[model samples]
Target: MALLALVLLAQVPPAQADPPISQPAGPHAVGLRVIQPAAPREAGLPAQVLIWYPADTSVSDAPPLRYGDLMATRLSALRTDLSATQLREGRAQQQASLMRRLGVSGQAVLDAPLQARSQAVPAPGRFPLVVYAAGVGGPADENADLFEYLASHGYVVVSSVGMGADGREVEETLAHVEPQVATLQALIRQAPQWTAADPQRVAVMGWSWGGMSNLFAAARDPQIGAIISLDGTREPALTRQIDVQRLTAPWLYVSRSPDTIAQIQRSGIDTTFSLLNAAQYAEVTQLIVYPMQHADFVSRRMREASDAGYGEYSRAEVRQAFGMVALYVRHFLDAHLRQQASSLEFLARKPVANGAVPHSLRIDIRPPAKP
Candidate 1:
């Protein structure tokens, strides 16, 4: 049966393959702390918030983060065995035995962080908060690398696990939005204890469906200072329900496919740019990565590439693409959340930072006339 499964896996789509991904080194050493905060909206389901932050010491020699069991549990529940073994075996620094024989392990660390210790004294001042939501059928740590990098760079990154349809069930995706928002609100309420979290400056980011949720949350809640999307768009009905023009937060969207961007445009999100208010579209930046599948936004350990759109690139290429994507994410947060003018200036000048990347990527800033 295992042999037959492997054969069937080989026939699976290229987009579905699990490629190895490195944490993409960041400035500060990273640390993690997990909290289960129950939101009032979905009191039955307590949300699990994975908090990643800059460590007081270097994490180079710290024990690697492990998530093989997490991936296996999520996958087995979905009836997908495509790369469960690979995830299970590569729990540490090395690949699983089966993947090693196939020569397909692409150098990914399943876990990130040296220790689960909290940084005492809170790294000088309260850090801006980043509430991250995962894609449909994804866990909070689906984009572990991105969260770790943000945390390492003096940000309090919080992601919810039970707030999304994280087990490959699309039908439940939309229904989880309100609960996800409630979860984030509850986490914010508890931020005073986190010490590192700055309740005043909060940014919400997400991948795929999570992206749409954050967008909705931003529309409803004015407290969110910024918004970031990893290839997510409005669900049509969402546009009709909420008035996006009321959303004044600076927005950054990094998408892999043009279709998704067009979908956002068709949903009338693009029209908000032309409003008379000068600040309406000043900070809205849309980035489209070429030759990058939706899976690239995800960590290699748990990516479901088969169902992703076409054009398969090697592991190295995917890493380079995502690194660039991460850079944009970092700089955007710096500009909006941290209120750094230099970061915004740098982004305007160097929109697409392609350092020998195989494909040509494009970054579009709204209005085209903003400084």
Candidate 2:
């Protein structure tokens, strides 16, 4: 599969190419913390949850959180046979690839004190919580760049490792999805203890399988106020299970290109039914990124994959589309979770009017159906 090919290529060293990644434009610096829930529902897999939050600007000088380190750790855990030398080489290759593609060393600082905890003054009001769900068998930090970007923008972002009931690759069935949903609920319940997260104003963001799982979590837990799916929510069987009436949360669905959709159809998979189409009672905003494929929605894959991974799109074009995805995600959260008037207006305008590259994406906004 293309995903397997990208993973294999990420382990190989790439030629140095400094294509700039759109850095987080938020004012606050980013801080990260990994918390092991006292009572995790899925005990079989690593239950450590990653929390990214706004941090004091002074901590920006702290050492950058190496993406390679995170990738290497997850890899070593999965493949116990790799030697120390092999692991080190893998780490180096991962970092080198990131540097080549993203043009940045790293964007986040590890365990830097939260803005509230660092200051002696009164704590600021809590930030909205965004629970991130990774793709099947993906790590908690699967979309590290997005987490950091959201954190910098003052949202408390949280994610856990994605695995099935067997503690391995997640399957697309209720039996497997139940554990993922449970993990999300557990994280939501523990948000207050972990950071300055406002549980009442919670949003669930997922990619691929995680995208579908977040819908399940939101359907079960009414506390979720918004949902963001990155090339997710397209699964027919999973979408059929969600009660759209219960999924009243405003949704932001970022999808792959039309060509990719056609390609899926060519493979004999039905591409007609979609959760986004079914949930008409709820407000929905969909952005079709013309350059991105299913895997490109995940920043790790976007940055590490070989040039061919982007298909006919240029690296710069794909990177631009990815950056636009982050911007839209931020505004969507701001509009629904923070109730910011500017963000609401931003979402209402055309993609070009909102500064997105022309022809790079298509946006459609559907207001909630009148009662």
Q: Model 2, which residues run further than 4 Å from truth?
A: 1-24, 39-46, 59-62, 72-124, 260-265
Flag clash pairs in model 2: none
Error of 2 at 27 (Å): 1.1
lDDT winner:
2
lDDT of 2 by residue, 83-162 (tens): 88898888677666555654542322111112222221212568899998888878776787788788878888888778
> Which ten residues in a row are the worst by lDDT in model 2?
105-114
**For all the candidates, what are their Cα RMSDs to the real structure?**
8.3, 7.6
TM-score: model 2 vs. ground truth: 0.81
What lDDT tens digits, residue by residue, belong to model 1 across residues 1-371? 99999999866634323333343555566677655544523543333556787765533444444444334333332222347465555443233532353334222222322223443323456788898877765776677667767776888887756344342254533565666666556665666575578889899898877777777677778888988988874555444454546667888878775556778668665444322233353367888887576666776433423222334666556666777787788889999888799888867764444342544467778742333
TM-score per prediction, in order, is 0.70, 0.81
Clashing pairs in 1: 15-305, 15-306, 16-305, 16-306, 65-111, 137-166
